[model samples]
Target: MKPFLCAAILSVLPFTASAAPSSSEVVESFIQAYNQHDVGLMVSHTTDNVTWMHVTGKKVKVETSTKAEFGAAMTDYFESLKGANATILDIMESGSYVSTVERVTWDNDGEQLSQCSIGTFRVTEGKLAEFWYFPAHACDELSLKPEVAPEVGVLQQTQY
Candidate 1:
């Protein structure tokens, strides 16, 4: 009788579904496209009236007047990369918001500069509507690896 009770309880145990993809996935997709230098997919994830801002509070209003114009702008940015690749090291998600630490590798006058950066994205209805990005800085010599590779960096508290 005890064995039968144990079996019944075990059978009744709930099975949890796999964790759904966080908004970070959207960011990751963008990162991959940026790395691969694919602009089409990068802009497709963004809504038409996307607002991309930087840490300094500078804003770009991407009201392309038409979807085609929007796509062209994205393509132009990608083409301008000239082999620049971005790597996403850490990502954390809360509700519709996803934050990630990234490293961007680009060249200037034959010198290679790898800058560490952090970006947060606000997602709505499966689209990334807006985002805020802190400027990238030179990495410390002691910490060779970017924070996002194995673990996520802790972010300061801010309004969502």
Candidate 2:
């Protein structure tokens, strides 16, 4: 009986692992398509009503765009820029949402610029439904940090 159970579990393991793409995998594929300037591949990962919100690090300001609009903007950006690339630092997933920390660089004319940012994506039905971008500093402030709490007899406590 023990050997039979082990064989059954082993047979199901591969199927379980390949059942569906994780949220992180979907986001990673989108990022790879974006870096390659493959608009079709990037759009294939999103739904028709996909929305993107871009935060400019200003005081409570966000620019919103739809799937078609974002595609056009990305096309223009790729055409105008000399080169662009993205390096993913971390990826986290919870439920249908995936968040990534990335360093993105672009070359324009003879100058290069780079910035670190956090991108949060909502994937539904195996397609991207929404996304939000925030500067790394903003995400840093929101990150979980340990704070010394001498009074609680604890060496450190998580600060939200």
Q: lDDT score, residue 8, model 1?
A: 80
Model 2 ranges with Cα > 4 A deviation: 1-17, 56-65, 136-160
lDDT tens digits, residues 8-53, model 2? Answer: 9999999888868888889999999989989888889989888877
lDDT of each: 0.72, 0.81
**Model 1, 45: alpha-carbon shift in Å?**
1.0
User: Against the hidden reference, what TM-scores do the models get?
Assistant: 0.63, 0.69
Model 2 whole-model lDDT (C-alpha atoms)? 0.81
| Candidate 1 off by > 4 Å | 1-20, 57-73, 141-160
In candidate 1, how many Å is residue 101 off? 0.9
Question: Candidate 1 residues 1-160, lDDT tens each?
Answer: 9999998877766533444456877778767876776667777778877677666547544335444565676677656655587877678899899998777787767888787878888887777788777766775522545556544686677987
Tell me the number of clashing residue pairs for each predicted model. 2, 0
